[model samples]
Target: MAAHNHIPLPIGQVPSSPYYIHPSDMNSMQFVSNKFKDEGFTDWKRSMTISLSTKNKLGFVTGIINKPNLQYASYKQWERCNDMIISWIMYNLDAMIARSVLYFNIAAEIWKDLEDRYDSIDAFFTKMKMLWDELHLQSYSKDFQTTTRSEANAVLDEAQ
Candidate 1:
């Protein structure tokens, strides 16, 4: 018989392939717990980003690496990686938030949804700080006119 080139098959397609074994679960302790708090969000984002990047799973969450084409040999491997990433994210999330995101089919959508929900917190705090600084800088006097102006400012600030 003539010698034939042996092309490797994609993972999970071949019953004997070692790639059929599942990957180890990601450690969740390093990431900030998503306690559904606005303050905890920044830490959670930073920690999760670092952890995912370290594991080379950042692309899955960022949508930079898409699922492989059906004809590709790596499709099964990609799916496994995607599922692992999704599980990592879910494992670190607060129960309520996890439930909300449980139905997401892709890691990118879950990442985007969480970002949209929590990323605005910084902006909100910044705006509030600016308003407070402006209020503090205003000169107030004992005179009726100045006192009235300060009162009006206080009302406006509270309304914000």
Candidate 2:
């Protein structure tokens, strides 16, 4: 029989409290339009850069609704984040459908009519190949009342 030595993992790699992440947080939740004089466009851009550059998937758009700042944020800012997040989710669904070679092990080709990424994450999803179906496309609409608090929370928990 051979004796073995067990090595311990580092604390940093142990996955402690990284940061409060909300999917909406990455969508520039506190961002006002470039027109808004007081708007923190810098924060918006910085957040977007951080989101895109992050190695963590949770750091992306999905973190928008997940991350909540203790400091007060305006309704406009929250609205902006919500709008961007919903749109991003729509685009993501569309892209996955578009880029998918197949679904559920079924023989299906969904990526037949979409383009490629233009500039950002939303752009990438928008650019993916997808067949235009007025009916099914409705499912991908932001108006769709599908996403819920628990649902998003579950996703966040799983990712974390």
Candidate 3:
């Protein structure tokens, strides 16, 4: 098996071919097993195609990471991106687990509330995504006062 394209998935009892496995789970398993230390990274990139159901497109906003040049990157470089995704997930997962243990009562903990109230991780992610996109553009537009003004305007407009 090609090292970069066929990292084993951590799904169930049976090990199937590369197609049926989830690239994300394969990435998590790569963390514990040194066998995945150098495993090819093709399995880690699960977002090349639209997920149809989630409708969430995956893109890296911060620094230069993998740019989806699937035809160009080497297995080693793929490994680096895999590491990056693992780190990002770890940070988010840490927040998620901490929020669960904290009983979901904190007002400053939106992610925790999302995780606790949502049915699945994907559902929580979709909600978080909406919050992130709407945040700076609308939620915090002018200041705290903008929220009240906007809401009052909307309500008044609705009544008219």
Candidate 4:
């Protein structure tokens, strides 16, 4: 056989590798200070994504680095990394939200559930805007007084 060109670095040694779990990466480590509180999912997701990316563990939740089979040598390491990622995710979630997903064993599954349940800010804003437009349309009647540009300017000056 030809010489092997690739040699796997020892565990926790390859900072760039997805499977490399840093010694400081504990299950109790909180990736972000703000917990996801069933709202502001976009901001919460962005913060967690940046933190996980920095640790090279984003793939765990993104489903890029899948869990290996039990017979594989890296299976145990994968479990450790997956569990750690799950714990980090759980820690960043609000108590109720975390408990909702507590039974999920896969990091990706928990991420998907959270995304499905709460990641709809864009749609929510769109719906709110539509409702506001509808309300504005409905609130206007022929009986209402219409202010001209000068009248609006006068009102602004008075407020100032």
Candidate 5:
């Protein structure tokens, strides 16, 4: 009987390493089912993060795995991972939003830009909600109600 020996590989060669690209991983792959529109940035981000983390590629966008210097041997591996991450992000984004970050070279930079842009959107929505609530509260209610469409139209005609 022959005994099999298992050899341990370096982190770079391990499947769990961010630098290690699985044969199945491709640039055209869509990580999330729902494409991110201009709104719902928070939910979109969460979905993307989960998908990336599952692939063991979360560090590329999170900036935890820093890219090596251009001259370094590992630089190419890092760049490939970064590009793949960017592709996944772009695939899940709306066309307009994707174009806005298309020129970005680094995955982390794209992530940061998206975060900054969406934060402003969140603030705008917050302000609009507050205004809506205030307006709703200030609106007056009448005791008499018009039950039919014609009655409502008559009331509107009277106002005119």
Candidate 6:
């Protein structure tokens, strides 16, 4: 009989603490403007997700609300998180955009509406092709080599 050596799988590293996004930071955060659909949508989405996660309110953005049968304490916590997420989103949005989503009571509903509006597969591919063309056009310009390294990297990161 041969003896086998057992190896343990590595555990995932835990975050030291929940992320915190200051209210002041939220106030100053760039609004998702009209150009967001064509140019900045992915970056805006990534930043918003990170901000929500850091505030420990990502559950409200991503998760469903508790059932009516849930305990009072659970329901209260959900409500608080939902309110915080809604406030944070409203604070960071353009006035026009804010008006559109202001009536959403569920954080997940707001999140889904934004995703459905901006993150459809066709939109993603169109954005990618536009970015590729822009990069190609810039490649022929004099400063492209020096100027676009960071911008190109950001575009690539968002595409993935």
Among the numbered candidates, top lDDT falls to 4
Which candidate do you rate higher for lDDT, 5 or 6? 5
lDDT of 5 by residue, 1-160 (tens): 9998989785558886788888888888887778988888878888889989889988888889888899987888898888888898998899999999999999999999999999678767766677557445545444233246575456445433
Model 6 CA lDDT for position 19: 25
What are the clashing pairs of model 6? Answer: 19-54
Report lDDT (Cα) of residue 118, candidate 5: 96
Q: What lDDT, from 0 to 1, does candidate 4 have?
A: 0.82
Query: Mind giving the per-residue lDDT tens digits that candidate 1 earns over 45-132?
Result: 8888987776666878888878779798777777777777777788787777889999998888999999998888765776677766
Off-target runs (Cα >4 Å) in candidate 4 are 1-8, 129-160
Candidate 6, residues 1-160, lDDT tens digits: the string is 9999977432211132222333453433443443233345567777887766665556667763432345653455456546666776776666777678899988788878877776775577777888899888988998687876687788777986
Better of 3 and 4 by TM-score: 4
How high is the lDDT of residue 11 in model 2?
Answer: 25
lDDT, model 6: 0.63
- Over 10-30, each residue of candidate 2 has an lDDT whose tens digit, in order, gives 322333212323443443233
TM-score of candidate 5 against the unseen true structure: 0.74
Error of 6 at 94 (Å): 1.1
Quick one: RMSD of model 4? 9.0
Candidate 2 local Cα displacement, residue 12, angstroms: 32
Model 4 poorest 10 in a row by lDDT: 151-160
Model 2, TM vs. native: 0.19
Listed in order, each prediction's TM-score against the native is 0.65, 0.19, 0.20, 0.74, 0.74, 0.54
lDDT of 3: 0.35
List per-candidate RMSD values in Å.
6.3, 21.8, 17.0, 9.0, 8.9, 13.9
What lDDT would candidate 5 get against the real structure?
0.81
- Between candidates 5 and 6, the one scoring higher on TM-score is 5
Off by over 4 Å in 1: 1-24, 27-30, 33-38, 133-160
Ranking by TM-score: 4, 5, 1, 6, 3, 2
